[model samples]
Target: MPNEPTASLSPRRLTTLGHSCVLLELAAADGSVRRLILDPGNLTAPLTATVAVDAVLITHPHPDHVDPSQLAALAAGRELPIFGGAGLGSYLSEAGIDAVTELEPGEHEIAGIQVRVGSAPHEVIHPALPLPANLTYEIGGVFAPGDAFARPEGQTEVLLAPTGAPWMKLLETISYVAEVAPQRMVPVHDGGLGPAHRTLHTTVMKKFAPEGTEVSVLAPGQSLEF
Candidate 1:
């Protein structure tokens, strides 16, 4: 696919920051780039000190998906705007982040980058576990579903799919990919797996991916360029 608009995302590339965290860099005409990081949680490394992030977009309130310390650090001294749907404000406030911009399920121009928040229900773990609001994001045409397996509104040229999670089964993973049917699918949310299990799960996803979709495994810190 060709590069999308800078507001929507361009170059169509991303870097894996462990688990469900994905980073997108949008290049502008003036030779500057805007960086957007999603779901920087316990599974990912400390990104504030290393990555020049313009904004942080979160999908949920789960500790594994939203790290307050990281958010505070990322916002320190800079006008780092944090974006997320409902149920994420208290978590940020508890971490001393005073102001957070609420992003409802729709298109938004965040930090000069246009992002679409996917409307997805957070998967259920058990009857007793408290379920909270969840969402997915379409950054630069790459659909990165934080924890849900649901497909979003538009055509997905590239997909950042969750390979393994507590709430999902192997069959569900296969079917999700087949249903989305993006040209490129990268595996995320696999931190729960050891080497052997990771290999097995990824193999199954690759095996069941739609014929034209290529399942790519992006190791932590590794990037994929279009």
Candidate 2:
């Protein structure tokens, strides 16, 4: 059988900072580069301090997705722009942090990078509990869908897939990959799993991923250039 054609991966650089946090760097036409941090809620040292972020993008207001102290420390003296969903903006403001821009589902340009926002319902964990709004972000060719199994507007060169969460299942995750059909898929939202479970999830995902799609699980502080 002929090999299936794979989707093209983005030329941008992606670095995983543990959990769902990612650092994305894209080269501009003038040889300059822009660096943006997404969901910097659980990043460890060294990686957290070394990354020179131009802006921060938060997908939701969950504590695991928005560590206020970490963000405050990161933006201590710098004029770092923080963008988040509507609910997140209110949460930050209530906490006395007013540096966040409320972004709805649309296209926006931030820190010289094109960002497209897509709305996706946060998986329901319980009937009584109110689910927070979730937003999926497509920055350049990298798509990070916060806590939702959402499909962005256009082609996804690199997809940050949530593998393990209270609101997700293995089968649903597999289905999401098939639906998005990206060239590359990386596992995120898996901080709660142990090493063995994490490895197992990665192995199973790689085995069942759609043809032409590459699934990679990065260790904390690891980076991959596509």
Q: Enumerate residue pairs that collide in model 1.
A: 7-114
lDDT of 1 by residue, 1-226 (tens): 1132345444445888788888787764455677888888887767564666778888887877888777766666776778887867776787777567877888788877778886788888988998878878887778877778878687798888887888999899888888988989988888778989999999888888899999888888877776
**Candidate 1 whole-model C-alpha lDDT, 0 to 1:** 0.78
Candidate 2 positional error at 107, Å: 1.1
User: What TM-score number comes out for model 2?
Assistant: 0.90
Off by over 4 Å in 1: 1-10, 28-31
Per-prediction TM-score, please? 0.90, 0.90
The 0-to-1 C-alpha lDDT of every candidate, in the order given, reads 0.78, 0.80
